[model samples]
Target: MENKKEKKQSKGRRKIEINKISKKSSLNVTFSKRRQGLFNKAGEFCVLSGAEMAIITISPGGKTFTFGHPSADAILNRHLTGNSTSGESSTNLVKGFWWDEQSIESLDLEELNQYVESMEVLRKLVALKVDEMEKGSDQSPSDFLAMDSNSLLDAFASSEAENIE
Candidate 1:
């Protein structure tokens, strides 16, 4: 056989350990790239399925990142307001509210009233938190908890109107 020089194979991607990255700069770069990839996949799903989608992720440094087909708020409001009484109980509870599966058909008037009142309280608390965030106020969660329900509802309504416009 004729002697021939063999060329070395180029190195490709290698398996990396799943340990925490030691380098801060590398970690940040990786986070940014991965976050972009996640958003791209969500957008692709939305486009291919004609379905609305939203993603909310908090970075390791506590900064929030969000991506939505139309908007995060719009998607959230749609999900919240969508009819949930289609003969199926949701296994997952809403982010800020909890309800059990005591059939509404079985509840008496007093129980129904109590349920409605509890829901109103939860709604006010959520609205207050949303209002503070919209106003860019530096108030803590405790401060929001201390606010009156009526004022919170008013703030929340104004914010809702602004969002609609």
Candidate 2:
């Protein structure tokens, strides 16, 4: 029995062809080691090339590994798209060159436009709700009012109450 066990241990140490294993436990262990090795390689590549990248993977044991670019998601998204309209987006394509031409004025304009669009949509929704209310519908004006009034600060307290429950 000891001789057989020693032979099996020696075989296990030898590199085996990658395939689905019948033994569930062994397969899981192999997957975890390979996944860690892959992440380490990615980190090395990032360090050497000075490039932005994101590699996300879940190990066989259900552990997650994530590698991010210096700017992280913002730069990764631009590379995936293959085209960029702004300087911020273009920086990902050219390594080590970091300059964002997206000015505060443009950012402010975008924010204002988004706010206006959101407000317009909300107004339309409220008008529809008001029409529904007028027709003796189940939905109340208070519901619409609450949705508009809810803010981030209020959301935090509401979430705390939910967790307590």
lDDT by candidate, in order shown: 0.67, 0.60
C-alpha displacement of 59 in model 2, angstroms? 3.4
Q: How far is candidate 2 from the true structure (C-alpha RMSD, Å)?
A: 16.2
Give the poorly placed runs of model 1, Cα more than 4 Å off.
Answer: 1-7, 10-14, 80-165
What TM-score should be assigned to candidate 1? 0.42
Cα lDDT for residue 158, model 1? 69
Where does candidate 2 stray beyond 4 Å?
A: 1-16, 61-64, 84-165
Clashes of each: 0, 0
Clash pairs (backbone) in predicted model 2: none
RMSD of each: 13.9, 16.2
CA lDDT for candidate 2: 0.60
- Expressed as tens digits, the lDDT of each residue in 1-165 for candidate 1 is 759878888777888779998888898778877987998999999789866677887766666677776556566666788943422222232332335556777999988886776576658768757887788886545345434557866765665566458
lDDT of 2 by residue, 22-121 (tens): 7888887686677668767877887898765777666564645555645446756777787454476355556543224334356577676755554565
Most accurate candidate by lDDT: 1
